[model samples]
Target: MTEYSEISARLAALPDAELTTVLQAATVGRPAFWAVRAALDEMAGVGHIAPGGDVSPTTESVQTHDQASGGGASGQVGAASAVPVVPVHPAGIPASPAAGGYSSGGVPTFESVRDKVEQRFGTAQGMGELDRQTPAGRSADEQWEAREKAARERLDQIRKSVHDNDNP
Candidate 1:
C-alpha cells in the first residue's frame, strides 16, 4: 500500500476524539497533516461526521468562484461545489466557529490543553526532577528568579518616572 493509504488507514481506525486531536496537533506542510485532513474530509464527505460533532449529514452546496478566470461566463459555469453544510444554533451562532476558545469541532484547542496541563502540573518554567536534583540547575533557577525580580523593579521605576512626567 502507498504511504498516504497507510496513514489514512491508521487515522481512520482512530476514534473521533483521537482523530481530531491528531488533526489539531499535526504540523502544516507535512504529509501527516495532509493525510489527517484527507481523513476528516472523507468523513465529512460521507454522512459520518457533521458540524459540532453531530452524526447527521449535511446537504448544503457552496459556490466556488474561479478567480483566475476573472469570473467570466465560462468561469461561472459548473462552479458550484457541493460541501457539507454546518448547522446553526437557535441563537444565530454557528455550531462551531474556528475562532471559538477552548475547543472547536469537538477538538480541544492547544491553548485550552496547555492551560489544563499548566493547572495540573505547573508551568514549563518550573524545574524538572533532574534540575531539582542538580546543584548547577538549582543555582541557575535562583539566578533566573533574581533577574526576574530585578526586571520587575526596573519596570516599576520606569512606570513611576513616566507617571511623574505625565503629571508635570
Candidate 2:
C-alpha cells in the first residue's frame, strides 16, 4: 500500500486514548505534530470521523494545515520546506568534505556558536531559568531580564572560583 494509505490505516487503527496521548506529547510547530494534525484533518475531510463529532474542516484549520504542509496548491512548498535537505555552510563559506565539516578559514561557523554559548553560560542559564520561575509579578521581558542578571551573577561566581583555583 502507498505511504499515505498506510498512514491513514495506522491513524484509523489508533485508539482514541492512544491518539490523545500522542496529541498530548506532540509539541506545536514541530513537523511530526503538523504531520499528525494534517492526517487527522484529511481523515475528517474524507468522512472518516464518526457522525456525532464535528469533522467538517473550518477555513482557518484548512489554511493552517496547508501552510504547515508547505501549501501544495500554491505551486510550491512553504519557505520552511525551501531549506536545503543537506546542511551547508552559510553563503560564501565553502564546506570541508572531511568529517565534522569546517567552514572556510578559522572563523566561527553557525554550528560552533551553540556549543560555545553552552560551554560559557550553560550552568548560569540553567540557574537563570529556575530563578525566572519565581518572582511571579514580573512581565515576560522583566523575567527574562532577571534571568540574564542571575546568569551574569552565576558567571561572575564561576570566574571568581576559577581565578581563586588558579592563584592558590
Candidate 3:
C-alpha cells in the first residue's frame, strides 16, 4: 500500500545475505543514508536512542520504540518524531565499545590492501562452479582446485619476496 510497506515487503523477501549486501550498497554516497544518520544522531543527542554513558550506536534496543512510533509491522518509525529514529545497528553485529569509535585508525597501506585482497581471493577461489560442466577439459572441481593451489603458491611467493626485501 505505502512506499514503506512495499520496501518492507521486498526487503522481507530477501535472504539475510542479500539483504546485507543491499544495505551495504545503499550506504555508499547515498544522501538518504546521511540524512537518516543525522536524524539518529540528533535523537541520540536529545536522549532518544541512548541516554548517558558511552553511546556506542550498536547497543540500542529499538523494537518497542519502533512499535510505539507507528512502525507496527515494518519495525521502522518513518516520522522523525517517531520513537524509531533509524536503527542503531543491524542484528547479529556485536555492539561497539563505549570508549572510542570503531576504528583501528589510519588509512590502509597498499600492502595491507593487497594482503586483504589476496586473502579474500584465496578464500573464494575454491568456491567455483563445481556443479557446472567446465569446457576446460578438466572437471570443475579439479579446475577450481588447481586454480586455487596456483593462486596460493603465487601469494606465498609474493609474501616471501616482500618479506625478504623488507628484512634486507
Candidate 4:
C-alpha cells in the first residue's frame, strides 16, 4: 500500500480519545505533528494535504484579490501578491535618512571600532587606576611591609624551635 494510504488507515483505526492524545503529545515542529495534523485535516474534509504533510487551503477557501474583485479571468495570482514584503536593516541603525543628510556609508570608523571592542572585551580604561588604589586605612606598600615583617618573625620562631629540639 502507498504511504499515504497506510497513514490514513492507521489514523482511521485509532479511537477518538487515543487520536486526541497522540495529537496533544506531538511537538509542533517535528514531522510526526505535521503528519497527524494533515491526516486529521483530511479526515475532517477541511483542506487538501500536500506532499511533505503540508496542508494547503481548500479551493473554496482560497481567493486572490483579482478573483475577489472580478478583474482577472486567468485565475492566476501575481508574484508580489503571493508573499509578503518586509524591510530589513542592521540593528541599532535607522531605516530612514538622518536630519543632516549624512550617511555612514557602511564604513567603520576608529571610534565605532573602539566602542565595539570595549563593549565586547569590557572597558580598557580605569583598570590600572583601580589596581593602584590603596587599601582601606593603610597604603599598599605599608601593608606589604607589615606582612613581610610578620613572616620573618614566624620564620625566626620556627628556627628557634628547630635549634632547641636539635639540642635537646
Best by lDDT: 1
TM-score of candidate 3 relative to the true fold: 0.22
Runs off by more than 4 Å, candidate 1: 1-127
Off by over 4 Å in 4: 1-130, 133-138
* Residue-by-residue lDDT tens digits, candidate 4, 25-58: 4633454344354344333232234467435533
lDDT of 2 by residue, 45-120 (tens): 3323445866573322222222345445546533223321222334454545532323444345566677778777
The C-alpha lDDT values of all candidates are 0.55, 0.53, 0.52, 0.50
What is the number of residue pairs that collide in model 4?
0
* Evaluation by lDDT, superior candidate among 1 and 3: 1
lDDT of 2: 0.53
* Candidate 1 lDDT by residue in tens digits, 1-168: 699999999999986645654664563345434434545444433424445754655344322221133333545543333543332233323444543333334455788687788876864545476676699888988999999999999999999999999995
Candidate 1, residue 81: the lDDT equals 33
* Candidate with the larger lDDT of 2 and 3: 2
- Candidate 1 weakest ten by summed lDDT: 61-70
TM-score of 1: 0.26
Off by over 4 Å in 3: 30-168
Error of 2 at 48 (Å): 40
Q: What TM-score goes with each of the models?
A: 0.26, 0.20, 0.22, 0.22
Best by TM-score: 1
